[model samples]
Target: MIHLRSLQRLTLAQRRRTATGLRAGTILLAAVAATLSRAPAARAAPEPVKVVVVANFENGADQGDAPGEFQFWVEREHLDHPVALRGAPDVLRRGRDGLYGMVLRHGVTDLAAFILDPRFDLRRTYWLFTGISGVDPRSASVGSAAWARWVVDGDELREIDDRTVPAGWPYGLWAIGADAPNRLPSDPNHFGSVTELSQLSKAFPLNAGLARWAFDLTKDVPISDDDAIRRARAAWNGFPAAQRPPFVLMGETLGSRRYWHGEPRTRWAEDWVRLWTGGRGVFVMTNMESQTNQEVMRTFGRQGLVDPDRIMVLRTASNFSEPPPGVPVTASIGDEGPGQRLAFDSNERVGAPVVRELLAHWTRYRDAIPGRP
Candidate 1:
């Protein structure tokens, strides 16, 4: 019934509509494909830790065992969450409070690994290194605690046989590039031909202001004391500091792998710390691991994994570095007696307050470090 021209015009209109529909479908498919391609892959953010309590070792289990450097912290802090460290058997425990405690055994390597672990975001975490040290009687009595400004390494020295050292030289240990004992090396970068010690000096300085802040904050905390330590303190006659009851002080720590004991060695530690710190530091405590740990921390800091200025070293006196008058070095070397318990107690009492304060003021402290203007 219709004309041929009208039928042809209708077919052309239908073709144009079909073409528009296909073009629109193609544009929508392209957009959807592009959106799918540009979508981000799923990823997890790193875990945040505000405070890390770095303890050297623990006596036994993490809980319900004889207390070690980590026990009182774990027990008192209620650090019940056990997070297994990747590639290591050790566990990093956490508390409901923003505190993390780990007892490191393989000193530097373990610490370095912990810091480099991708699982933790430690950029703002503060490190509190707490341990018992052989207390210098001249610095403090047993059970006393010291906030350290410097951790001087007693290792990394050239040693000749003490019996063969030149006359008047106190001990065999001397700087790597120095000619005599108690002397500084002209160039810190070179550690002889055999050992390349780099420019990292033996003196590992902590934030002086922070150390003072901690000392002032807890100086009045009642340090635990016992009759055995009291009686032992009496043996240190003529040494005024040793004779006094346990109290907090600001002092430096001398760390050496060798557990050297005796009056002569004590004198060496004193001189060594003074020598390394340019006489600005005095040796008050002796330990086996501070230097290694601090050195690792410094490296991590440089790597942007941590803030080195936030590090604090707190040493409680478990025993005297040297024997008391009339006691043989061999006899008193390993006799911590009641001083160990007192030191443990002091560590908790003195350290807990700082931890609590940090937690309470995290809103402010999270951005601004304490003792900084």
Candidate 2:
């Protein structure tokens, strides 16, 4: 009988040779097919056409409005053309994880073409991201829409050296705006890169109306009474002067245990918003959970994926600080849910105008952007 060891060696060698021969033959066949197929060389894959929508649980106080508004604008209006709107897989929520899976499912890589192929769009299509974010109470008011010069996955995080310095030590990955005029000037040790959308912004500044509409919708909403806003500011004030982070970072999706403090996972679902809408803009709104303001902006400043000039972050103040001693604090902000009208009726009225504005912006910006379909 043949020795077992010798037999094994012979089998392995034969497998390797067969594999090599198969590869060679495959290449030969491909060459022949290419010649026979057509006179012109095969064209590169079409450029990826995508957009992103964020359903923040912040400002609107109800998650319902965010998703509902996105569906109406993206599916009903913008996507009325021949393009397709791909649905992302449902996120897995369990254990200590909250929105962690949601973020990975929606991060830059999980986006349409990125999920399919980083170079999915070589020539056609576009990607867009829409959603809500919190604005600095000092700088922005409730319902006002603002665009990001850069969008930092405020929640998605990595480790950093737990050391303090005069200049500030940097550690972590931040996606900056592709079209941002200047790179973030903070820490030099952090990981930063301009995103694909940022490049598109340079060619086209994105529809200005989307930002305008967000402003219109929330412009009148009272921010003085919201509890979240009151508490967030208080939290900021509570921080020691030396420990306070420079910029305010706010997003509903960031506070969840899943992303801000979780393991490596796919943020694919969130990426769907990008695939459906050609990259146009990024929206920052509010959510139920309160998060560290400095942390939020630091994340954005680090990434540089969004254009800071175009960034719109809108926040409705839920609560204002009470006056001390004999002073009385009046309720300056409006209620969270549907204001005066019935919930359904109010949503339709308030949301319709916003949608219309978005469509108008899309038409103007889409046509203006270079390399856009």
- Best-performing candidate as measured by TM-score: 1
Candidate 1, run of 10 with poorest lDDT: 27-36
Q: Over the stretch 247-324, how does candidate 2's per-residue lDDT look in tens digits?
A: 222222222223221111112212211222233323232332223222222223333322223223323222111221
Computed on alpha carbons, the lDDT of every model, listed in order, comes to 0.76, 0.28
* Count of backbone collisions within predicted model 2: 95
User: Which pairs, if any, clash in model 1?
Assistant: none
RMSD of each: 18.9, 16.7
Best by lDDT: 1
Candidate 2 weakest lDDT stretch, 10 residues: 27-36
Compared with the true structure, model 1 gives a TM-score of 0.85
Q: How far off is residue 3 in model 1, in Å?
A: 89
* Candidate no. 2 TM-score: 0.32
Clashes of each: 0, 95
